[model samples]
Target: MTKSRIRAAKPDTQPHFDYFYDKPGSLPGTLNIGVDAQPPVIVLIDYNEADATRQTLATPEECLPYLDTESVSWVDVQGLGSEDILQRLGQVFNLHPLVLEDIVNVPQRPKVEDDYEDHLVMIARMVIPKESGGFHSEQVSFILGKHYLLTVQEEPEHDCFEQVRQRIRYNKGSVRKLGADYLAYTLIDSIIDGFFPVLEAYGEQMEDLEDEVITKPTRQTLNKIYRVRRELLNLRRAIWPQRDAIAMLIRDDNDSLISDRVQVYLRDCYDHAVQILDMVETYRELTSGLMDVYLSAVSNKMNEIMKLLTVVSSIFIPLTFIAGVYGMNFNTEKSPWNMPELNWYWGYPLCLAAMAATAAGLIYFFWRRGWFENFSDVQDRTSRKRG
Candidate 1:
């Protein structure tokens, strides 16, 4: 059974998703796709206000018939490592040479570009649910033409476009009435929304770390806080560039594909991107402050310990010296002063009283100077249970 499960388990090793490339300075449109990809599977959804048709396309050429029709076509290609299939898809869509290059670049920076063709190429990043419920990011290249959107996702298994697909299948929204740009907006909006739950989880994790850092900080707490800060930094890096890209989509004058109505929707998506960026920035600042607080609390704890040691030494060092002085053996028999005190009946009691009085006086002095209060304050805060 163990062997069977091991064989069935998903591989943890990440394979390289290299960009389809040519030797340096080679001409564009050179296809260097991977041999390991399954034959490209194209799912085409064509919709207009009156009717819609969805079909599993056998080849890239099959999409040709739908592209020229009066409907908005969305052709989603899951994997792009296949060279011959990608080349044919490029031709069937009549994609520009640079456009194909942009699409095949596995991890292009999120951007929007216009080349005076009847299209706009956008590189967007999509983060989807991982098998472990955490998320991983992938680049999605979009070729938004006059009437169709050709979206290529870097990975097959993790995607949040299923809802958009479902909406297309069920005609749940005004998707049928809008153009391909609107459809692109829907998918991008979904991808942006997908980031929220992940961030909410991070926020809660940071809050928990805050409590841990304050109450009983350990080396592990420091490590964990630092890790959270690092992760937040990564998140900030991801979302910051995305915010500018989405803002360009909403504000830039790309007259070819995105419509005015669609730009409004894009504005909403941009708002979300901005909100995500804001949260990331806020979290980053909080994490930085948490580090400071953690260090200060640790230092304060050390200071309290040092104060206690000082107090103990201050109170006992002189007392120990006094005891040592009295413990000395004098020639009492030879000297009348030394022998007279020893012969007194109350000498031992008087010495004991003097020691007690000295201890009491020193303690009273400490209490009057508020040293004891400072010590007790540290003890109380450290010991008190905070809800």
Candidate 2:
């Protein structure tokens, strides 16, 4: 499979569903195709209760024969880089202009729409956990009709639908026996379940962060927390609206495209969406708390350092005073009262002994008060933890 490094078409990002960048007062249904998009790869899977068939189609028109047949047709289009193929595919499927625009604009919010009367249009985000770390996310657009389900994705590389494909190919279950709506639910359920591994990765990272933040937090630790928080926010943004969309799919009685049986399956999908949202929110809160803990740990470290410096300074105060008094020039031979000990043979040794004794006493006093114990305890605890 070929991969494309798709670039952002607009410098500013679209923050939500209601806000987007486009020419002011321009046509509503205009497509914003990315220049670096890959050419589309279309796959068709047509199945009935007896058997199923899967093939790659060279053109959008090639699947026209199966669209109106008794078998359920699933046309999977991966990549939106080629404008001609996308436009032609829209034409072949009888897609509305706005629906086509939503499919191609890349990064529309997850939503469900049945306004077109013949198609149930849904937009969803799929995330795949990277092997190194973090995740990759993309937009998946679905157009469900009477006898067919058409899916358009942003790229070919970041898909998690191989399991669903395998199930249909091997006749492992009832997918071959179901209609297009059930097929749509299977794919949607796959998308919902995909978030778990990504969340699991984040959960493991959060556990590691908890240890690092408490024991050995540096500026780098803070940066990691912020990064995790930002990504979790992305997960939240991608997932929270999905719960709403799935709920709409389950409760949307007016959309005749979704069967009653499919809605029952969709209820389970909705619960998974809620569970994923809860996990995202929980991770976000943990990351935030980690930030606060980091600040407190750093501050406490600083206080310990300041206290050590204070104890050292206190010990030196008296020694400095003793040195200062003897260093003052005194005419010992001219006056009897001017430090007579300067004439003694042991005066030098005596002065040194007094300075050492003073420092020792002060240190002993501080140690007895437990000021020095925490430093040693901290070192011991750190060493033990590291070991």
Candidate 3:
């Protein structure tokens, strides 16, 4: 009947859960890019101690000359629009078939592989919050070589690597003097830092939900709690393996591709990942608690409503019995005990007065027992606080 009641009665839409996976019994090295994937854009940044250069290259072959030089070349390929271009880029960089497959795939578990003699393969998921709400996750694959580092992203619209690019462009913080391994660490660190903003957004959302659940929980509050829990679960899934990957890069030195100095930086990155995971887990637990609170709040509200109905029914039971007895078809003239009062003029007025007195007495009893005090004022206070 009212806007608030209508809103509270509406059902929540179900959430969608999705993940990327290959078909059963399919090939091990299969590339399955999404149909909506954006076209590729290649950008090269080559630098030495003395100078730095950034360019948008037309072809993957153009990166070959810079790769062979003594300068550190960063070939950043954004988006996976064309299979042909991706394959050609792989060929130009001498990427292993399996490595290329991993790069082209839209979603892959975060991991690091040092099996290749000349290069290191690292797969990481990067997440950024959307303008509306929630977050967007994209898989970023890295191929680290002696003189160059190849980075591939699933989409071109969003990335957190712009700050790292700025650092390299300006030769700030000894980035130009460092090796490509250090460059990889810088980018990884940037990726790890990006998680903080998304986590902060969820933290604020959870706080608001906490207040809502305690004060004025509705079906929408329950839905919001579940949604926060689910998103935090996704965040945990993305960060856990990434932490292990960075730890592996630090502990395992079989390939000797990562320098000792860069490993120190990676250890810091690993700490950041662990911190992110801890926050995610904590928030998830809080959301679970919020769900419990929501259920309890709903039950309490229902109990209050039922109690009020019970009191009203109890007050009317005796009055209804009196009315039923007076309405019975008794022969007033046949027996004096049957209805002598029915012939009296004051009988009707007396009966009405008696019913009124009974109702007033019962109401006074309930009021004295504090039943009525708990009904209206407490609910009004709660509603005002919620508003």
Clashes of each: 0, 0, 0
Each candidate structure's TM-score, on Cα atoms with residue i matched to residue i, is 0.74, 0.81, 0.82
The 10-residue segment with the lowest total lDDT in model 2: 11-20
Task: State each model's CA lDDT, in order.
Answer: 0.76, 0.86, 0.84
Q: Where does the lowest 10-residue lDDT sum fall in candidate 3?
A: 1-10
lDDT of 2 by residue, 1-387 (tens): 111223335533322232234555767777777777888999999988888898999999998999889899999999988888998999999998888988988777899987787788999999998897878888999999888999998988999999999998898777888889899999999999999999999999999999999999999999899878877887888988889998888876635878788898999999899899889988999999999999999999999999899889977977789779778768888998988888889988998888789778988998899877877788999999999
Q: Which pairs, if any, clash in model 2? A: none
After superposition on all C-alphas, the RMSD of every candidate to the true structure, in Å, is 8.2, 6.9, 8.6
The runs of at least 3 residues in candidate 1 whose Cα sits more than 4 Å from the true structure, single-residue gaps closed, are 1-40, 129-134, 311-387
For 66-125, candidate 3 gives per-residue lDDT tens digits of 877889999999999888888889889888878887787656679999888888999998
Give a tens-digit lDDT track for model 1, residues 226-245. Answer: 76676566566666777788
Model 2 bad stretches (over 4 Å): 1-20, 325-387
